[model samples]
Target: MAGLGGTKMKNTWQQVKKVGIVHRLLSFWSRDWFLKVVSIWLAIVLWVLVGGEDTIEKTVNVPVEIINLPRGLVVSNQYKKKIEVSLTGPRSVILDMDDRNIVRQVDLSKATPGTMVVNNDVDHIDVPRSLTVQRVQPPSIILSIDKLVQKQYAVVANTVGDVAPGFEVKSIRMNPEYVMITGPGSVLSQLSALQTSYISLDGFRRSEQLQVPLDLSPAIVSLIGETSVTADIVVGLVVAVKTVELPLVVQEKGLSLLPKTVSVTASFPQILLDKGKKAKDLLVAHAERYGQTDQFNVIVTSQNNEEFPVKVISVLPRRVSEGKAKLLRATTKKKSE
Candidate 1:
């Protein structure tokens, strides 16, 4: 009996061991394991078919970058800003590259003051390790370098629009009439002077003083002195000239004038003329009250108000005939004396 029981226990243990062996074998062929093997094999096959020792050419635009420029020097000419690069490299690497990955570098550290021609090649360009440079559309570029220079230029004031009706511009004064500027010699040599921004004088009636900035280019030129200037504008009163006719008045009784009117020229403030005041309203003529003869001198005066001062320029007739001129008849009855 004991032997039979031991045999039964041994068979059971053997059966359990066989089950464990089967489980171990099944673990190697599970769903996750099968997927991993398939993915690796597919990746290898695809690599061999698509990117194995194969090269392709592609054209891309790369920006030109300048570096290592010497101090106090500038490039005066605008050359090719971008270049087309034809690259021959592995298909896998070329397909992955975008416009940001490639760039052409230009070294101007040793440049001098002259026209220089630089060649484009792989040595100066930055690219991926797997890609090779085949050709460049513009194989060379020309640049002009110049020394920096500075000079003083006169500043002119510019004004736009007109002043008030009764006022005129007396004078325009700029505090600093000149400005010092620094820039490339090629551009600075051609510049003569600078101008201020347009100053609007529209509806200006009084003297004005303001600070105005100068108009200058920011890219290539720099101002060394004060960027702003003090503009002093003076406005003065305007005088208007006008002419009018006034009736000649006789003060003495029984006195009559031959010419009833005379032309009077005067200068007055422009403000008074624009206030609906006629030139004739400000003119008057007077005669002497004690004059015995009919002829008298017509004195012209301006009746202008206190606000408007009028200056009499001229009078058409200084003397007037009030029927006073008569030929004394010495009873010439054929001189019947």
Candidate 2:
């Protein structure tokens, strides 16, 4: 019985030993460092087989923006503003790039008043990767456009200087007072008024005609067209002459309570004087009675063939009694050439 027990015990011990050996071999192969190294090598071989160093070419459509345009002006040409890029690169890099990375620039400085077409050249794009441009979709674009117009504005007149001595300017008048302008709407909108040059009338004695130039504001002039306009101005002058008092002389058949003398007043040039005309020729008289006034118009004629350059003065009463006679004193004045 003891021998049999020993055999059983020994067999069990051998089985335990075999189990320990198997566990030791398994632990060696399952270590973290060994598995990590094997995985890295396997990934490298797979990448090599898939052409990791090789580049792939592809074309893409990238949208871009334009800048610096005049106010009210629109971009009417697409090809001039947009571009398509044909790029060849590693698939990973190319697929990761944003549209903005591949840019297109179009210059519009020389643009005119009509539709413009812009054709983008794929070669202009600068790609940092091992990539080559392949194609551009919609190679060109068209832009439509129009010109803008400005509005009319008012101009103020500035006057200077005085009229002749003893005379004054009563008023001034202008024809076609305002000026019209045409240009870009943005610039025209900023202008509120126009101004004329300084007008000097320093020593003028009689009525005169003047021509003044119209000056436009910078905002209005920038966008103007070929058409232009002129402004017409008219200045009026009023003069005051020297005046004197003259007495009236009444000598009619109807006589009643006659007055010793009556006076009249007149205005004329201070340089010229002639006094050889009768009262009827140079003076007029009138009378009022019972709230009714009588008026008369007198014509002055030289009776002595000597031109009495004098004009009729106003009567003292302006009117007298119908049946009374009255005498008037006369004053003379000289006239200008």
Q: Report the number of the highest-lDDT candidate.
A: 1
- TM-score of candidate 1 to 2 decimals: 0.50
Every model: Cα RMSD to truth: 14.5, 18.5
**What stretches of model 2 exceed 4 Å from their correct place?**
1-150, 184-186, 222-246, 251-321, 324-337
The digit string of per-residue lDDT tens for model 2 on 147-226 reads 56647677566677765553456555444466676654545566677656666767765566566665555444544422
Q: Which model scores highest in TM-score?
A: 1
User: On residues 96-146, what C-alpha lDDT tens digit does candidate 1 reach at each position?
Assistant: 778355678898999999999999976667887777888887999999999
Residue pairs clashing in model 1 are 257-322
